[model samples]
Target: MPRMKVLLISLAFVAIIGSLGAALYFMMKDSGDKPKSSHMARALAFRVGFSILLFVCILVAWKLGYLRPTGIPLQG
Candidate 1:
């Protein structure tokens, strides 16, 4: 289960990064006298939406006991 969760989250991150890369590519490709393009904006919007969905999924998983938070130990 933990492995599945990790895989799913990793895939989501990859998709998010891919969307970001697409946005950057479109931005650079459309940078010459064509009015601002919508492709970049759409890609960015997809990235934002995907990010929110990922966050919500993680939150729900934690609430349903499929995930737990872990990090560096507190010095206190």
Candidate 2:
């Protein structure tokens, strides 16, 4: 369904953003030898916030009948 596609696309976008954020955080941390006491906290907060948002999106999509599971076979 179109709605399913939309949800999938949105999830993919969120994943990409999360990955980029994590990569940036790590790269910055690696390059800097200074103490990063707050770095881990910040990253954790971002991940938790974004994960909650993603969960809410999934719930909404499921409730609206936009995301039904398809038992399709996957190729190795």
Candidate 3:
């Protein structure tokens, strides 16, 4: 496995977790009387975006020959 690819995947996982934590924080911190644009919602959106982006990145990297699946092969 490439070191850079590993690092990037690790970073993406961290980012996704961090975004989720932030959303939780905002959810608990907000007073519920806030405006329609909630910070918690924004954080959750960011988490979703990061997750999707990470998935796409992994796919692209695999297509570009940067990553390879190492799991057990399916029985055909």
CA RMSD, predictions in order: 2.5, 5.7, 2.2
> Which residue pairs show collisions in model 1?
none
**Candidate 3 RMSD to the correct structure:** 2.2
Poorly placed runs, candidate 2 (over 4 Å): 1-35, 72-76
Give the lDDT of residue 50 in candidate 2. Answer: 71
Q: What is the C-alpha local distance difference test score of each model? A: 0.90, 0.70, 0.85
Best-first order by lDDT: 1, 3, 2
Backbone steric clashes in candidate 2, count: 0
How far is 24's C-alpha from truth in model 3 (Å)?
A: 0.4
With candidate 1 superimposed using the best TM-score fit, by how many Å does residue 52's alpha carbon deviate from the native? Answer: 0.4
> Which residue pairs of candidate 2 clash?
none
TM per prediction: 0.83, 0.51, 0.83
Clash numbers, per candidate: 0, 0, 0
Over 1-76, each residue of candidate 3 has an lDDT whose tens digit, in order, gives 4787788889999999998998878777746677424878898899999999999988998899878889999999
In the range 37-75, model 1's lDDT, one tens digit per residue, is: 678899999999999999999999899988877888789
